[model samples]
Target: MRRLLILFAAAVAAPVLAADPAPEIRRAPVPPQALGVAHTLRTIPEACARLQGEFSGDAAAPYRFAVVRTSPGCRPRARLVDAAQARPSPASGWILNDLIRVPSAACATQQAVVRVWRQPAQVAPPALDPQGRARVYLEDSLQQARAGRLAPLPAYAVSLQVEGLPCPR
Candidate 1:
């Protein structure tokens, strides 16, 4: 009886001991280079043209800034302004976290009024700061694209609505 009880206890304890600990979430600060890149992208003709095309058809279409590392050539400029970890206003559970640049015309000067939103849950908070989270999301998007998961937006994304400036006519 003693042997059986010990074995049972050990078995129960083993599972508990072996269980993996939850991953620690941390917020990483936005790198200064990211801001520099955003500024560079605004001046790049190729990037401006791409933005023009992206918003031409549907100005309100869901979109996120293309990661600079992944798209070295031409991509929209986006910067994380708010982290999902912060408490959202009571009016909405979603937080406007990103601002993407929209060109007034192909290769013309740009304006950043496009707002991107993500729920607290979507960001998997505490692990990364707003910019860090955005980077991860952009990287994941690249992977998904390579795998042929051609969805317009990541499922976790809440909204990519244009707030101020509309795409130039």
Candidate 2:
């Protein structure tokens, strides 16, 4: 009697305690089909401030990066990359060597295109303010990548090729 009640309560509480907590994701999501190539050349301080604004109060949030074509005339497409794949650009203060794959409906093959985006100025992320925070976020990203937990920040990875997801109205 009492033993059965205790067992039931323990069973109910076990899952609640063992389950992983929900990730803190941001609300302002980038448009799935972003309009154009990102040509903004911002200095580090400016970039840090914008990045802070982009992630709101949480500076550790994963940012939404896009690899759009430099030229216009085609339907704009943007694909999100995980922190694991976003290699820091040595030439510029940005992510580079990111592999962007354009999904081909009829085939399963993937091709890698190499491209680097260079901003016009030498402005760096702020030294002690948001810059420090950005550095911390990137470092955390590196740690998370090692642990295979990289995609939970900005939003769970979205695949345009998923069969059952409904189209946005």
RMSD for all candidates, in order, please: 24.5, 19.7
lDDT of 2 by residue, 132-160 (tens): 55444678768969999644222112111
Instruction: Give the TM-score comparing model 1 with the true structure, all chains together.
Output: 0.23
Local distance difference test values of all predictions, in order: 0.36, 0.30
Write down the worst ten-residue block by lDDT for model 1: 29-38
Question: Which residue ranges in model 2 land beyond 4 Å of their true spot?
Answer: 1-98, 112-114, 123-169
The numbered model that scores best in TM-score is 1
The count of residue-pair clashes in candidate 2 stands at 3
lDDT of 1 by residue, 12-74 (tens): 545633542321222342222221133322222322222211333344542234423335564
